[model samples]
Structure formats: structure tokens, C-alpha cells
Target: MQEFALIMAGILLAGAPLVLATLGETITEKAGVINLSLDGTMLLAAMASFALASATGSAWTGALGGMAVGAAVASVLGLTNIYLGQSQLAVGFILTLLTRDLAYFLGHSYSRQPGPSLGYWGIPGLSETPLLDLLLGRQSPVVSISLAAIALCWWWMYKTNAGMRLRAVGESPRAAFGRGIRVRFSRLMACLAGGALVGLAGAAYSLAVKPGWGRPQGCEGAGWIALAIVIFGGWHPVRAAIGAYFFAALQVSGIYLQDIFPSIPAQVFQVAPFPMMIVTLLAVNLGRVGFVQDLMRRYPFLKRFSGSWPITAPAALGQDFDPKKGL
Candidate 1:
């Protein structure tokens, strides 16, 4: 039982970044902005946060700096795409490459160096509890923040008027504008906010989960996994978080399996999650194909799962919002 608890905690720790990043993207897409620069943004933020933290010897300050970097990148993407009438996809893709290379170049000095890790602060009584102790006792503040983000985002999106406006802008900007909502401004804000969250995720990686900076570039493909999780989760915060945890569990399982079967190469386990995610991604879209649709129809029981297999994306995602079209 203790071992199981430890494994679950490990999964949560490893999955925190994914949870935060996926939720951030969900918020961005919900507000009608698609930021494809997630991978690069995270990498850059990780390096920047590590450097800042090392310089100041303060984790919180470093996290704030990371958020600023993320928000700045996101703001540029949002403004250029929304106000300047550029293609969001093109701009995002370009920014991804640019930010990634920039991180490598600028972070040359900070790479592979030791820095301060985030401090763990468990709740008083909760930290001493049975299973909870193992689960939450030694967790960093970022883990709690990530979990809280999920709940807060879920509430803000489903239960608030401001959230409704956010959805309105994404789903039908023309209608939202007609209703007197500032569609462009709303989307711009969403992108900035989402980027901040993504930045926090990056910082969490270096300062807590993975620790230290540089070589191995462990965080490289995390952004892509988070994005895939958003799709698998149907853009819902809770569902997306669940997907993140599942993926993390898969990763953990791979590592454990390698120890049990020494004959199997360690690289196989390390790379297993990528292909698994790809297969899951394909499964999510299977509803769109004819054969899968036919199978779903023939096997009534399959409908329980298949009906929601391919979740529909937000109506206006990835499109440039034209003011003239709305007016």
C-alpha cells in the first residue's frame, strides 16, 4: 500500500507540468487563440527560470520571471495574430522554432549547472496524515498551484459570466461582438494568461520535478504531449488533467518494467509513451472515419465510449478573427 501511494505521488509529480500546460492551452483555444509555440515557450521558460533562480537564489522570483517571459511571448502571438491580421498558425510555428533556438543560444552558460530547487511545504495536519503524508508531504508549492489551477480554470470556464464571454469569443466572435463583448481584447487576455500558466509549468519542471538545468533536454517534447492531452481531454480541464495523469502513469510504468525485465533495453521504456500517445491520438479521431462509425453503430455497447471518441474542437480555433467580418 505504501509503495502504491509512492508511485501515485510520483505520477502526480511527473504529471504536474502536463496538467498545467494542457490547461493553459485549453484556455487559450477556448478564447479563440491557438498558441503552437508551447514546446519552445516551455523550453525557453525552463532555462530562463533556472537562470533567474540561480542568480537570485529565490524560486518564487524566478517563477514570476518565467511567467513574464511566457506572457510576453503569448502577447506577441496574440497581438500579431489578432490585431495585425497575420496567420496564427504561421506565427506560432515560427515563434516555436525561434524561441527554442534562442533558448539553446542564450542558455549556453546556464545549461548543466546546479540551481536551487523549489522548497516543499506540506500543510500542517495534512502532511502527517496516513496516505496523504506520502502523497502531499514533500510536494513543492508548484504542485499545489498546478492542482489549484485545474479547479480554478474549470470553475471560471463553466460557472462565470466572464468565462461565458471567453467561450463566446472563441465559439462565435461575431456574435460575441454583437453582444458588446470585446472579442479581440478577450482573446488577447486569454493568450497572455494561458502563456503565464505554461511558463509556470516550465519553471516547475526545472525547479521541482526534474530539477537543475541543461543536458538531456528532458522537457523537449513535453509541450507536444500536453497538446495531445488537450485533444484527448476534449478541451475540458478535468478530462485533460486525467489524461495527463494517465500519460504520466504510463511513463512511470515503463521505467518500472525495465527494472523487472533487465533484458529489455531501457530506451524502449523511455520512448514508449510517445507511440502510445500517438495511438491514443489516432483513437480520439477514429469517430470521423467510416469504419469506426459503422462499428460504433453496430455495437451498441461501444457507443458508450465511441460516441465521445472524437471530441469536437472549439468552433473558431486557429482562424484569424477579422473585425470586418464581425461588423
Candidate 2:
């Protein structure tokens, strides 16, 4: 039982980064911006956080540094895409490569260095409760922050006028503009805020989960996974968080499988989650397929539940919002 609790804790901690990244992307997409550079943003932020932490020996400072890097990169992406009217996707992709290579080059000196970690913070009474402790009480502060971020983002996006405007801009810039909303400003704000969250996720990876700047790159590929989880969750904060935890659970289960089935190759277990998530993404996007439509028609009940099950992206996702074109 204790082992199970520990395993659950590990899974939650692992999911923290994904939760943050997915939610950030959801917000960015909701505002009609596609920051496809999440992969690079996370990588650069991770590297920057670790480097700063090792140099200053302060985890908080490192986190701020990481956020700065994320915000800066996001600002550039937003400015070029929103103001300059460049292709968001193309600019994001190019920035991704550029930031990634820049991290590898600039972060060379900080590689394999020791950094301060957010050590465990075990609450006395709360930590004693097995389930409660594992879920919320006994975790590190970073885990708690991730949970809080989810609830806060969900509320902000669903219950606020500002959030409605964000959705409005994404759904129809023309309509939103007619209502006196600043489409470009909203998108730029969203991009910056979303990037900060992504940076925080990267900081969480280095300053707590993995606990150092070294070999193995614990944060590698996380950005891509988070992006997939965003789609899998249908772009809703709560659903996206669930997807993050689900993916983390799968990853932990793979480790267990490696132990149970010693005869199987370890690499297989390691690579399984990627393909599984790919299948999930494909399934989400395939909802409108002819076969799916036919099945839905055959089962009237399916139509009623489809929307509730897989949250869909905003209609204008990835499109450039042009205010000059009568918007």
C-alpha cells in the first residue's frame, strides 16, 4: 500500500509539467495563436533555469529566469505573427529550431552541473493520510502550484469576461473586433501569459522533478507530449490536466512493466507512450470521419455525448487574425 502511494505520488509529480504546458497551449490556441514552438520554448526554459540555478544556487531565481526566457520567446513569436502578419506556424517552427540550437550552444557550460531543487515539504497531519497525502498534502510546493494553476486557469477561461473575449477572438476575430475587443492585443497577452506557464513547467522539471542539470535530458520531448495532451483533452483546462495525468500514469506503468516482464526489451516500454498518444491524437481528429459520422447517425445517443466527451478546439485555431481585413 505504501509503495502504491509512492508510485501515485511519482505519477502526479511527473504530470505536473505536462499539466502546465498543456494548459498554456490551450490558452494560446484559445486566443487564436498557435505557438508551435512549445518544444523549443520548454527546452530553452529548462536549460535557462538549470543554468541560472547552478550559477546563483537559488531555485526561485532560476524559475524567474526560466519564465523570462519563455516570455521573451513568446513575445517575439506573438509580435511577428500578430503584428507583422507573418505565418504563425512557419515562424513558430523556425523559432523552435532556433531556440533549441541556441540552448544547446549557450547552455553548454551549464551542462551536467548541480542545481538547487525544491526539496520535499511534508506536512505533518496531512502527510499522514495515505491517499490525501499522495494526492495533495505531502507533495512538494511545485506540485501544489501545478494543481492550483489548473483550477485557476479553468476558472479564468470559463467564468471571466476576459476569457470570453479570448474565445471570441479565436472563434471569430471579425466578430470580436466589431464588439470593440482588441484581437491582436488579446492574442499577444495570451501568448505571453501562456509562455510563462510553459516556462514554469520547464523550471519544475529541472528544479524539482529531475533535480539537476545533467545527462539524459529529463525534459526532452515533454513539450510535444503536452501539445498532444492539449489536443487529446479537446483544449479544455480540466480535460487537458486529466490527459496529462493519464499520460503520466502510462509512463509509470511502463516502468512497472519493465520490472514485471524482464524478458522484454526496455526500449519498447520506453517508446510505447509516444505511439499510444499518437493514436489518441489521431482518434480525436478523426471524429468527423465518414465512418464515425455513419456510426453516430446509427446511434443517436452518440451525438448527444460526443461534445461532452471530447472538447473541440476553437474554430479559428492556427489561423492568422487580421484586423485590417474588416475585422
Candidate 3:
């Protein structure tokens, strides 16, 4: 039992970066924009954070630097999509490729270099507690931030007026505008806020989780995984956080399974989580089919569990909002 608890704790620590990234994208999408440059953004932010941290000798400064990189990229995305009325998908894809190449090129000098790191710190009194200490008291600030972000985002999205306006914009910008919300401004703010979180996730990887910068950074595909997790989580902060933890568990299990099955190829274990997540995503979608809806309708008791059902995307997710066009 003790070992299991430790393993779960490790999973939460390891999954912190993904949780941040997923939550960031969730917020971006909730504001009716899709910042698809997450993969490249994370890579560039990781490199920037490591390089800055190495130079300045402060992990927190590096984190801020990384967030700036992410916010800058998101700003470009917002400018093109919201102001210029360009296609969000096209611009996002371009940015992803651009930022990715930029990271590889600019980060050549800092590859594998030693840098300042965010170390584990235990909360004073809480660290003395038993199970709670193992689960939450002793961990890096990055982990704590990820956990806090989940709660804060959930509350902001569901309990605050600003959050309601943000959601209203995503659901139907025209309708939201009609109701006195400033759609474009709200979206831009969400972009900046979400981008900062995404960037922080990258910093978390380089400064805490993996603790350095290098080609392949072991975080190459994490952004994409985070994106999928946002969908798997149905765009809800808490659910999305759970999805991050689930994937983290898969990754940790793969490490254990490798030792138990020495004869099996290690690469198989490494790539297993991707395909498994894909399958889970497919199953979630399958539950939304017509027949499934019929069954839910036939049995009203199932409605009690409706909160668990996967949600569809926002009505204005990828569409450009132009006030001049008048809805």
C-alpha cells in the first residue's frame, strides 16, 4: 500500500506539466479559439526557460521567460484570427511548425547544458502528516501550482461573472455580443492567460519534471497529448486534470511493465499510452451516438450521471468573430 501510494504521488508530479498545458488549452477553447500551436509552444518555452535559468540562476525567472514566449505566440495567433479574420486552423498549424523549428535552431547552443532547477519543498507542518504528506505536502512548486490551477480554473469558469462572459463568448459570440459582452476583447485576454499557462507548463518540464533542455526534450509530443486530453476532459478543468493524471499513470506503469517483461521491446511500452488514449477517446465519442442517447432517454436514472458524459465543442470554437459583420 505504501509503495502504491508513492507511485501515485510520482504520477501526479510527473503529470503536472500535462495538467497545466491541458488546462491552458481548455481555457483557450472555452473562449472560442483553438491555439493549436501547443506542441511548438511547449518546445520553445522549455528551451527558453532552460537557457534563461542557466544564465540567470533563478528557476522562477526562467518560468516567467517561458510564459512570455507562450503568450507571444498566442498573441500572434489571436491577432491573425480575431483581428485579421484569418483562419485559426491555418495560422495555428503554421505557428506550430514555425515555433518548433525555431526552438531547434535557437536552442542548439543550450542543448543538455546544466541549469537552475526547481527542487522539491515540503510544506512545514503538512510534511509531518502521514498519507497527506506523501500525496501533497512534499513536492515541487510546479506540482502545487498545477493542482491549484485546476481548482481556480474550475471556480473561475463556473462561479465568476468574468468566467460566464468568457463561456458565453465561446458558446455563441453573436449572441454574447447581443447580450453586452465584448467578444473579441474577452477572447484576446483568454488567449494571453491560457498562453501563459501553457508556457508555464513548458518551464515546469525543463525546470522540474525533466530538469534540463535537449533535443527531443522528452516533451516533444506532450503538447499534442495535452490537446487531446482537453477534449477527453470535455473542456472542464477538473475532468481534464483527471485525464492528465490518468495519462501520467499510464506512463509510470509503462516504466514498471518494462522491468516485468524484459523480453518485450521497450519501445512498445513507451508508445502504448498514445494508442490507448486514442482508443479511450474513440469510446467516449461512441457514447454520444444516437442509440446511446436513446438509451439515456429511456432510462431517466442515467440522467443523474449526465455530468460524466463527454461534452461537445463550443459553437464558435474555430470561427472568427467580426462585430462589423453583425452576426
Indicate which candidate wins on TM-score. Answer: 1
Q: Per-residue lDDT of 1-327 in model 3, one digit per residue for the tens? A: 667878888998889999999999999999999999999999999999999999999999999999999999999999889999898889988998999999999999989888899988787787566777887777888988999999999999999999999999999999999998999999999999999999999999999999998877988999999999999998899999999999999999999999999999999999999999989887777667788779889997876665466578888888888899895
Q: After superposing candidate 2 on the true structure, give the runs of residues whose Cα lies further than 4 Å from its correct spot.
A: none
| Candidate 1 residue-wise lDDT, 1-327, digit = tens | 888988988898889988999999999999878899999999888889989999999988888888888898999899899999898889998988998898888889987888898878777887557788888877788778878999999999999999999999989888888999988899999999999989988888888888878865678989888889999998888899989988999999998898899998899999999999889888787787898779878887877887654487889888767777646
lDDT of 2 by residue, 275-306 (tens): 98888778666767888879998998878755
Worst 10 residues of 1 by lDDT: 303-312
> Which runs in model 3 stand beyond 4 Å of their true positions?
290-307
RMSD of 1: 1.5
Q: What is the alpha-carbon lDDT for the whole of candidate 2? A: 0.86
Global CA lDDT of candidate 1, please? 0.88
Provide the lDDT at 215 for model 2. Answer: 44
In candidate 1, stretches whose alpha carbon ends up further than 4 angstroms from where it belongs are 297-301, 308-310
Candidate No. with top lDDT: 3
Give the whole-model CA lDDT for all candidates, comma-separated. Answer: 0.88, 0.86, 0.91
